[model samples]
Structures are given as C-alpha cells and as structure tokens.
Target: MKLHGVDYTSAPSRRKGITIASGELHGDVLILESLTSLPDHAAFDAWLRQPGPWLGAFDFPFSLPRELVEHLQWPTEWAPLMRHVTSLTRPEMRETFKAFCDARPVGGKFAHRATDFPAGSSPSMKWVNPPVAYMLHAGVPQLLAAGVTIYQLHPGDPDRIAFEGYPGMVARDITRASYKNDLRSKQTPARREARERIVGMLEAGQHRWDVKLDAGDFREALVDDGSGDLLDAALCAVLAAWAWQRREARYGMPEFDALEGWIVGA
Candidate 1:
C-alpha cells in the first residue's frame, strides 16, 4: 500500500512549509520514495484531494482533550465538534481558550488527552509555541473535506487513513541528542551528527519497526535537511509503514477515546 508521513504547518511559505515523505512497504522494509513540500494551504488541500488509496501518518493533533471539550460544553462528537472548532477564527479560538485557562488554576491551565503522556506531545489546546490547536484547526477539516478516514475518530473514505504522528517519539527512540532546530542559527554540527545517527538508525531498522531505508537520494535527503522537516516526515513515514504492516492489528495504537484520537506510534 502507498504510505506517507507529513510534517505539517498551519501557515506555510516557500522557506518554511509542510513536508511529505512518500514511500511504500516492501516486506519488513519501508522503501523511501520522494519528499514533497506544500508551501501553502491551497497546495496542501490540493495534495489531500489527489486520488489516493494511501495511508498517511500526519504530524498534527487530530482531536482536543475530552475534558476541555466537556468543560467548554461543546459538541462531544467528532464531526460536529470539528465543525464547531473550524467555525471560529484563530483569534476567537485564542480568546475562548484563554478564557478557559483563566477560569482554572495556574498549574492546571490545559487539559490533556490520554495519549499525550506517552507521546510526549503538547496539549492539543495549546495555541502558542507549537500551536497544535491551530494546527488542528487548519489540518483536520481539510482532511475531513478530502474524505480521509481518521482511525477511531472520524469515518470518511476508507481508502485513505490518517493517523496522528509525533516525530519526536521516534527521534528520541534513536538518540537523546538534539537533531534539529528550525532557527538557522541553531543548526549546529552536533545537530547534524544527530541527524546522521537518526538516518543510520532508520537504515539499520534500529527503531524496531523492522523497516530499512532504500539506498540513495531519499536517504541523503533525510540527512541533508538540517531543519529536520524531511527527517521528521521520514520518521512518520516509518510509523505509517509500521501501521500498514499491522493494518489488521489496529496499528499498535491502544484503546483511545473516540474524541481524543491516539498518536500512531506513541
């Protein structure tokens, strides 16, 4: 089956954009194919709508915390809840979420999904820094509109399955070294070394996904991009391959709240 791993962005540009690693699984190995970047929302939407019988692991939150949704008294069902969320502008969402946090104690500002702990992911409601809340707002509706099936969360076209992915989990699995920095100034030799290690690990199937990389440009591409977007997308691609290998086994994802979807490789 066709597989992809996407490093997504809410607002993308030519310099900073979404990266997609596309490949296929051959027995236990995931053959690296190509990496494509979509620098804007229109490009992203067009890619999603492209004819696909493909499964993808996307680096974006698929759902908000069930507690947060309940606290806000929003619709608990997946589709309607997404509808309500996508209706608001980013500023409106920030204001509403800020109000929610303001009413609570300082340490308990954000409600987290069950998957967050194991995945080491930021709370889905976080609107700043990683801005996963905005990512969800920007990403999910498009996926739904494109007719992709989100496992355990929303049902759409069965031919295209979308699973939440966190590349950090896979990166940390290989080493604790800092591998990437979005800031050009922070892309140091140590980070490059770390990237090399990660590439080597993936080639060797050291992450225990039983998948090896194809030799050539794709492998070089993963290491050459010090920003780590390509590598992150590659990591997600490996996870997608793992999930595809075990498609009948629910992709190693645990029982997750339907409203708070699980990360695929968490």
Candidate 2:
C-alpha cells in the first residue's frame, strides 16, 4: 500500500511546518521516495482530500483523555466530542483545561490515555510544549472532512486509514542518542551521529518488524535537518509501512478506547 508519515504543526510556516514522508512498502522494506513540506493547515487539508488509496501515520493525537472528557462532562462519544473541541478557540481550550488541572491533585494534573504509557506520549490536553491539543484541533477535523478512516476511531473511507503515530517511541527504542530537535542550538554533531545510528538500525531490520529501508541516500536525508522533523516524519513513515505490512494484525495496536485512540506501532 502507498504509505505516508506526517510530522504535523498546528501553525505551519515556510521556514518550518508539516513534512510528509511518502513511500511504498516492498517485500520487507519501505522505499523512501520523497519528502514534501506543507506550509499551513489549509495545504494539509487539501492534501488530505487528494484522491488516492493511502494509509498515513500522523504525528498527532486522534482523541483526548477519556478521564478529562468525563471530568469536564463533555460529549463522551467520539464524533460529538470532536465537534465540541473543534468549536472552541485555543484560549478557551486553555482555560477549560487549566481549570480541570487546577481542581486535580498536583501529581495528577493531566489525564492520560491507556496508550500514553506505552507510547510515552504527552497528555492530549496539553496546550504548550508540544501543543498537541492544537494539532488535534487542526488535524482531526480535516481527516473527518476528508472522510479518512481513523482505524478504531470514527470510520469513514477504509482505504485512507489515518493512524496516530509517535516517532519518539521508535527513536527511543532504536538509540540512546538524541536524533532531532526543534532548536537549532541542540542539533549537534552527536545528534547527527545518533540519527545515522538510528538509520543503520532501521536498515538492518533491528526494529524486528521484518522491514528495512530501501538502498538510497536516506541516512543523509534523515539527518540533514537539525529540527528532526524530517527524520521524525521518516520514522512515522516506517511505522506506517510496518502497520500496513501487519494490517491484519491490527498494526500491533492494542484494542483502544473509542474516545481515546491508540498509537499505531507504539
């Protein structure tokens, strides 16, 4: 199947934004074909509507914490909750989430999903640091509008399956070296070395998914950028390819809650 891994940003720009790693899975490898950077959410939404049979692993949360939702007394159903979330502004969301956290204990300020532990993902309601809350606000509605099937979440067009992916899970598993960063100062030679090692591991099938990277200049491409967005996108692509190979096995994703979706290959 045609596979894509998207490294998303809530607010994209010409300097830094969404990068999609596109490729096709061969017998036991994913051929890294090309990388495309989209500058804004509108462009991403348009890309989602392009006619094709492709499965993508998007680097964004598909759902919020069920605990948080229940605490807020918001719509418990997936579709309705998404609608409610999309309707709110970011400041409004921040205030709502802040109030929720303020009422909770210090050690448990943020609610987590069942998949968060294994995936090492941030709380979906977090508005800063990674700002995934904004990503969900920007991305999920577009997926719904494009009629892409979201695995165990709301189903639409099956051929265009959109799975949640965490590149850190794979990167952490592959090496101890820091591979990519958003800050230019942190993108050091050591990190580049780590990226090389990670690429080598993936090529050697060290990930144990029975997949390898097709022979190419992928190593250079993965480490060329300091922000690590490109490498992360590539990792997500590999995860997407792995999931496609094991599509019958539910892509190694656990049976997740309908209101809190699971991350594929986490």
Candidate 3:
C-alpha cells in the first residue's frame, strides 16, 4: 500500500513547510521512496487532491477536547464543529482557550482528550509552546476540503484515509533526549547523534511497531536535517505502516470519542 507520514506546520514558508515521507509497504517492511516539501498552502492543497489509494498518518490533532467543546457549546458533531472552529480567528481561539485555562486551577489548566495521556501529547487546545491548536486550525480544514476520510470520525474519500499520529510518542519510545531544534545555531552534534540513534533503531526494528524501515539513500538527509522534520515524517510513516497492518481491525484504534479523535496506536 502507498503510505505517508507528514510533519505539518500551521504556517508554511520556504524555511518551515510541511514535510512528507512517502513510501510503499512490502510485506512488513516499509520502503522509504521520497521526501516531499509543501512550502505553501496551495502546494499542500494540490498534494491532498492527488488521487490516493493511500493512507497517511499526520502529525496534527484532528479535533478538540470534548470538555473544551462542551464548555464552549460548539457543535458536537465532527463536520459542524470543524466549521465552527474555522469561524474563529487564531487570536480568537487563543483568547477562548486562554479564558478556559485561566479559570481552572494551576496544573489542571488544559482540558484533555482521553487519548492525550496515553499518547503523551500536548492538549489540542493549547495555543502556545508547540502551538498545536493553530496546527489543528490550519490542517484539519484542508483535510475536510480535500474529502479525505478521517478514520472513525468523518467519511469522505474511502481510498484516502487519515489518522491522527504522534511522532513524539514514537521518538520517545527510542529516547527522550532532545533530537531537534529549529534554530540552526542550536542544532548540535549531540542532537544529530540522537537522530542517528533513532534512525538506527528504526533500521533494526526496535520500535513499538516492530517494522523495520528501508530508508535507502535518504538516511543521511534524515540525520543531517537536525530540525527533525524529516525524521518525524519517517516516524509517522512507521506508525502508518503499523496501522495498515491492522486495517481490518479498526486500524488498531480502541473505542474513542468520535468528536475527540484518538491518536492512532496510542
């Protein structure tokens, strides 16, 4: 099957665009074919519309926390809720989520999807730090517009299935040491070594998925990027390969809130 793992950015530019690792699954091995960059929204939209009998694991939250959604009284269903969220500007979203966090006790600030704890992910409503909220704002609408079927939530193109994927979860399974920094000055040899170690583990099939990666000549680029975008995409590809193996069994997903989507393999 054609498979992809995407490392997404809410704001795309020449410097920090969305990165995709594309491959094909042959039996249990995922052969990495190419890495592509979408440096702008137009490019991303075009890529989405490309005919696909492909499955992808995307590194972005698909929906909001149920508690946060109920508290805001937004539409509870998937499509309507996304439309409502899209109605608000990023600053507006930040203010709304900020207000919710401000009223709660410290250490219990953010409302979480049940999957967050298990997946060890940032809350989908969090607007700063990782700024995943902005990611959801920018990314999900594209998926909806593209007519991709979001597993267990919304149905569109049956051939183009999307799953919520966490590259951090996969990376941490190898090591918790920091492996990426966006600033070139801060991209140290130590971090490069960490990326190499992570790549080595993938080559050896040491991750939770137990699926080895055949990265071919892409190995050096994956290690040298130091931003971790390439490696993150590869990690998501691993998760996608794992999920594909269990496609007949609900893609390895447990019972989860349809509105608050689950991270695949969590």
Most lDDT-accurate candidate: 3
Encode model 2's per-residue lDDT on 29-128: one tens digit a residue: 8899888899987899899987669999999999999999998899999999999999999999999999999999889999999989988889999998
The lDDT per prediction is 0.89, 0.87, 0.94
Taking all chains together, the TM-score of candidate 2 against the true structure is: 0.96
Report RMSD for candidate 1: 1.3
Model 3 per-residue lDDT tens digits across residues 1-266: 78999999999999988999999988888999999888999899989888989999999999999999999999999889999999999999999999999999999999999999999999999898999999999999999999999998899899999999999998999999999999999999999999999999999899888889999999999999979999999999999999999999999999998999999889
* TM-score of candidate 1 on Cα atoms, chains taken together: 0.96
TM-score, one value per model: 0.96, 0.96, 0.99
Clashing pairs in 3: none
Query: TM-score: which is higher, 2 or 3?
Result: 3
User: RMSD, each candidate, Å?
Assistant: 1.3, 1.4, 0.7
How many pairs collide in each candidate, listed in order? 0, 0, 0
What candidate 3 gets wrong by more than 4 Å, as runs, is none
Candidate 2: give its CA RMSD in angstroms: 1.4
